[model samples]
Target: MPLSAWRLRLLIVSLLTVSFLGALDHTVVATSLATITGELGAVEQMSWVIVSYTLASTVLLPVLGKLADLVGARLVFLSSLALFVVASLFCGLAQDITQLAIARVAQGVGSAGLHLMPQTIVGEVTSPRERPKVMSWIGAAFPIAILVGPIAGGLITDAWGWRWIFWINIPVGMIALALAVIAVPHIAGRSGRRFDIVGALVLGVTVTAFVFAASWASAGTPGTGIPLLIAAVVAIVGLAAFIAIELRVSEPVVPLRHFANRTILVCIVLSTVIGVGLFSVVSYVPTYIQMAYGVSATVSGLVPIATVFGMLVSTLVTGSLASRSGHYRAFPIFGTAAAAIGLFLMALLPPGMPLWVPMLAMGLVGIGTGAYMNIIVAVAQSAAPRTDTGSVTATISLVRQVGSTTATAIVGGLIGVGVTAGLPASLDASTLTPQAVAASSAAVQAQVAELYSSVLAPIFIGLALAYAVGIVAALLLPHGRLSDELEPQPVVGAENAAETATA
Candidate 1:
């Protein structure tokens, strides 16, 4: 069916609303992790909750996206949203860390659909000329969710308990599901293509292994030794097999032909670096705030507000500039420089400094993050042919997730090292407590704060290094813009008929 412009817009918005919930929940539970750990008696497994979700999401992103293209995005999206709601309920009701971790994996699987399907929907309805503007607007929702999510979660967790973090998704998901069913246009996939089952399994195991290794090592435990080694070896083998398989398959999950485009390859690498810096810094900032200032969970949650504000403003400005001038080189260049500078400044926060200083520094980080948000995707898409748009978008998403996961592992390890190294040798590891140590009159609280501060600085500096890598990658990326005819178009025969009948 030939869809009217208004109807298409309605459909896209409805889909994005659902998409926003998926994206929002990704970080909502982060700040409340401590509370969850205490209640569940599993503080050590805290990072796994975060890692499992990201690992699940990262592994499935490209696979699910390819499946959407093979089957139908409509079915995948609705089913994923439904699963997200159900999984969230399970997460809220979980009696153990294992249950919570499993629930998170399910949520992550659902998130893959949420992250992918909407972009497909957007592409189907909007024209190439309008895509940048429309994409810029659609992108706004994700950041907006990020900006408010922590505050919302903090309030909910503080008032109702951490369980509400999962419970909150129920209403939001229901609304999104209702809207998606009503307005979303049905788009079918290319038939006769086999879903690369082996490839998917390899990718899943590799991601899970790598994530597990990172989380284990970060826990400052000796048990992680064998697992980390095994994970690394398996990931290397899995990746090699995937590359070999993709090159031979007629309908490969990852289109190797696209890699031939030097520009797209460079952009993917740069995005990976950016993801490392962005997620590591954003994910751990609250921990720093909590330790450095001894702030309450609710108050510490506000620390990210500065970063969110900066992102909001910079994104709007840069997006408009790109749309109007059609020149995109400066975004990443300025973004990387600003990010590096911001991270360096953050590292320099003197011991016991007031909260405002670090908050201001986060604002700078946000500026850099916002500046490059869509520029990477835009460059990748423009470098590819029209038919490759979905894969191209999915590629960047996958790359970013890998980078973020790697960074989380690296930074978490660094933080652990700093904390461990700074502790007095006379202190007992198993029964250590900030207050109890302080009572012993051994300069306990001061020493603990000092160790945390020392550790935090190096993590921030590594994040700066990641941004520097992104700058180099951005410089290497080829220059281009979207074509005039890039807007949404109907698939020639049956799919269009299905859409029309629905209309």
Candidate 2:
């Protein structure tokens, strides 16, 4: 077989490694975010640190998938890896928040491919049935990397420096790239496919506008509210125009029609719902702990490893079970139900509860998350045609990002509202660091902590509701056995694959 030399295990490791790098960078700075912003003298701009990378990555995900479908996944992967490594170097060297954010944007562009290519590549070499097993290993990397980031960031910042976090990507990315080049099979792109340049451009602007509008609105920085409104209007208009353009174009950046499929529609809805809640929990809980506990970033980061641990257990168990049984629908339904319970418990916690309480609650959510995302993705991919793999995967990722971005905004807004109404003047909610809060008067510290916990409680409650909705969505997923064998490739495409890899 053409894929014999590719070594399935090695290919899985290589893809996981690449995806892990992207996932790591997207979140590595989170635990150290306050520290990074404090040092750069732009604490007010802190959310931008995460938002910039997320925004850039969110917009590019589907576009890169389309490009890979047109050119080659290997070519896109290699180029993206090279770009990510270089951008990381600049991110580390950045002297100011602006410079750091700009570097992060470049890094995000590369991150999009790193996050997307593994899903795309798995489609290349493995049967649909095999992917649950392989993706269980590969897909777990992104979530694990995301969860481990705070711990990694805290530990690194405690010992080395925050800058080193970005710098570390260079060596790891290089190794992943080298391994992929040596081990991964080349899958040829569709012949004579016309790239949808115009549609792609419109999509980029639309996504950017929506993300920024959400960011600005969430921050609630006085003068920025109007800009957010303007951005929102632009985003709405862009969405309408982008849809119109995509429909008119011979080859749309996103094939909107595929969205009509019940499986695709349900999977996307699930992605959006799960993505909103899960990404919010992953992004904010550590920050919440750091602020409320007045603990160092290291300790704050450590607690969330339980989330990583829980996710680890679920992904391995569910993935292995689904692969052998060829049944995946139950996982998402069970997972979302479990996650909703955990989140509800999170919302119900009393003030001044022990640290371990949150650790447990968040861990439960992780368990649920681990089961749902991978299974949902596999089901969606299985339902789509073979030729539609990359776009479909990209669409899933893009929609998930959109959900994440929306959740981020909603969470941030909730916190902002709390700060405005209840926070004392003595406490600067915008620039809170664990170290700074520790030095403040005990009364001020307690007030700040209480306010934060109060605000976060509702956010969790809201997320619990979202996951509850996901349960119904998951139930709607199609239940049929995925194919046990790989779909046969066209003879011409198969022959050109090796040639394309070399070229």
Candidate 3:
């Protein structure tokens, strides 16, 4: 009755594939923002589309990761996938930015399930030794999806329309859903414990408030300050309550025991740093190109390809190295160090330099960022007991999300508005008026690019500092291969046929 080897492998692939749908949706919207803004009159509200989706995913990752441990992953995985597809439909059909933003919130909730659950599902189905190789596929899928997103968006938006961006997810989501139901392993919920309602509420509010403050810190100078202060107060109060509730609750939402491991402590610190760099790079690159070089949206989307290519290139090389040497620490150490250097180098570029120069700079950062994931995540999970693997995986992810969101907010604030007060002499617009600015927005957009390029260095430097911390942590990680004894025990089957299948 145990699943055939083929079915198990198929299940892993299916989960990663569905997860990729959610990941792809994140980046695909970046290049098409201009079109969405123009059509929906959402210039000011445009940032929310990215922030909301990311914030939702960040907040839910820890909760859902723990949920996967409590209730079986099979149920949670399918439900999340179904929600993502439905939300995509709503997003595509939205008439206004407000409607689209609301739909995006739904999409974000669905995406959290897709993002966190797949890793847990993979852990459930594959042995610890086999997990690295399978996880490589998952890690690789992330950059590939991100890289392809813009190209696909450009082609679709240019040929058909922006709606196609969301529309394309329909077929992919359904296919992943069908495969998951057919192929994924069935897991049952753990018994004898109730959901920690007080803890869940407190943590949820804490994450929500903090994420909003961090995500929207760049909205305006005056606007961001008070809200950020309020959010800080809410986060502190909520976190205090969460800790108190967890201490008293018979069953906590996140078991504090999981944080006791030294390795996990190191991994969490490193993940936060990596998160800051990775998210900062992804969020700013497209805007950098558009604002600095006066490129069209379609053209701007292509800039990320350099980073994507660098990531792909490094992944293949380092993966082979890890496999050959059977040592993982060296890769992350090198990767993070290189990434810090790359980010610093990017800071040196003058505003509005040639396209190829900036592209190469981003590529360097990509190479470094791409190399860190497999090494760190694998190391972190290996450090925890088997029963806590899902928890550890989710924890790293949660830290990264918080780091990235925090980075975006900080960078957004530093970069100020992506607009310049002066236009270049080469750009002749003698009749520049507010009315004309509205009609011929492209000209105004050009000035913004010049300003953005000039200020990109400081953002990269801040990112560089984060990656530097990650490198230091990677160096301190204990060096050894993962052992099965360190893993969680496998579940016993419920019936004769189920037992046979599990066997």
Candidate 4:
């Protein structure tokens, strides 16, 4: 039996809440990192707070998807929510940075399911024609969370304390859990399929090694040179091993045949490029605003909201349009072009211009980012066989994670190189701070601002080039009506039928 319209709506809300919580936690933690470190007294291990969560989340994505297929999506989703809530409690109670890091790893394990299962559920519930609209809402939660996080983190830290950031999730998690219990259907999982344990281990190791290497390289922390090199070598070897293992496995963690479809390959490539371009803006623009304009962190954070608003509007509108027309290629093509234009405008803006100028530029980039978000995933999911949906979705997510990590590393390198090249030899470029710039003489400030502007121009230029490549990839995407394929297996069990009737 199909779900009642109201029940379906409630289920979507539950899923979106989970998505928002997962996305919000990351950004909130990012905003409060300085404050957390000040009290925790473990500056050396601070980055792991983030790294642990990211590592755990990235490693578990494919495995969780496999579990959902083998067991059930509802079970996996509820388990993930429970783990996340418990981890949040532990994180709030953590007395040391190490404890917090471990708690975060557990949280990340839950987050992997929070992030991926919603889409899987939506796919199971909705036909291909209606998926874009629902997914757009799910996808919008991420950017909205990003937009809201810093502001919320700053306020919460100032009023209550940093721990409240974790504590806050308890109530939200409870409500989501209740709604999930009432609304989610119990779709059966496939039996007799072997879990790809070897492939999972190899891929997990490869991703963890790469994440650590990227973090080290990007951080440029003192005395990490040898460790960074070793991690990089390990990542390369692990990746090779993962590929070999996947090819030979009876049921691979990521099915290789999916890539044979030109649509999936093109979407993957475009997704990588979009990840580079999109994350560059999200990760670096605030720093650019502060350094270039001498604005406070709060004020700098507010500017990205414009981008988020732009993204919100486009996501809803484009998703509705795509749903109606059953066409999606145009969204990515147009969106990437707009993004390239936006990045170019941002790069060209003069230092210390009125705030609105930069906000407008960011809004353009946000539109592009929104366009790519749900549509690519939808395209990739539609392109794959019904049985392979979970694996395919996980693979796309894995590629995007790799792209984001690589982009962060690349952007960090660019900033380092630019600062070194632009600053005077005596400046001790590494020691320079926004306060130092504010305290400098007019001439010095001008010189510093000019250096930052020059570096930023190239960074945005690089971003534009990345989106331009995405535009080409998007053009190559296969054109067809979105597939209306049904799950090959039918829902069974009298108990499930009775539950659906009662709901």
Which segments of candidate 4 are over 4 A away from where they belong? 218-222, 424-428, 484-503
Candidate 3 residue lDDT tens string, 103-135: 888889899888877777666665444455556
Score candidate 2 by lDDT: 0.80
Worst 10 residues of 4 by lDDT: 494-503
lDDT by residue for model 4 over 1-503, one digit each (tens)? 55678988998889899999999999999989989977999876878899889889989989988777777788989999999999999999999998999999999999998999898877767766678888998888888898789889989999999999999999999888888888889967786889999889988888888877887787677899999999999999998888888899878888777666677787788778766887755777787788888788768866688888888888988888888887888999999999899999989988889888888898998888787678777767666655666776787787887788777877887788788778855466768777777777777777777788899898899989999998898888766666444432221332222112111
User: Among these predicted structures, which one has the highest lDDT?
Assistant: 4
Return the TM-score for each candidate structure.
0.85, 0.88, 0.83, 0.93
Which model is ahead, 1 or 2, in terms of lDDT? 2
Residue pairs whose backbone atoms clash in candidate 1: 1-496, 1-500, 126-488, 127-487, 128-486, 128-487
On residues 1-503, what C-alpha lDDT tens digit does candidate 2 reach at each position? 42663488788888889988888876678779988999899998997898788888888998898887777788888889999999999999999999999999999999998988888888767776677888889888876776678678889988998899999998988898899898777778876978998888888998888888877877777899778889999899999999999889877889886576667777888888777888766757777887677677767765568777888889988988888887777888988998899899978876567888888988898899888677767666666666667887899889888888877877877787886688878766567566777888989888878877788888888899999899998887655666666762221222232122111
lDDT of 1 by residue, 1-503 (tens): 44687886787688668867887897688768899989999987787898778778888888877776777677778988999999999999999999999999999999888887777656545443344455666667677888777777888899999999999899989999998898877776776877778877877787777667666667657666787788778878888988988878776677776566666676687678767887766767776776666665556656677887787788777777776666666788898889888998888886668888888888888889888786566655655544555666788888888777777777867776776667777676456554445455436656766777888887788788888887887776555544444432222232232122111
Segments of candidate 3 deviating more than 4 angstroms = 1-5, 37-44, 95-98, 157-164, 215-220, 286-303, 316-326, 350-357, 417-454, 484-503
Q: What is the C-alpha local distance difference test score of each model?
A: 0.74, 0.80, 0.72, 0.82
Which has the higher TM-score value, candidate number 1 or candidate number 4?
4
Highest TM-score: give the candidate number. Answer: 4
TM-score of 1: 0.85
TM-score of 3: 0.83
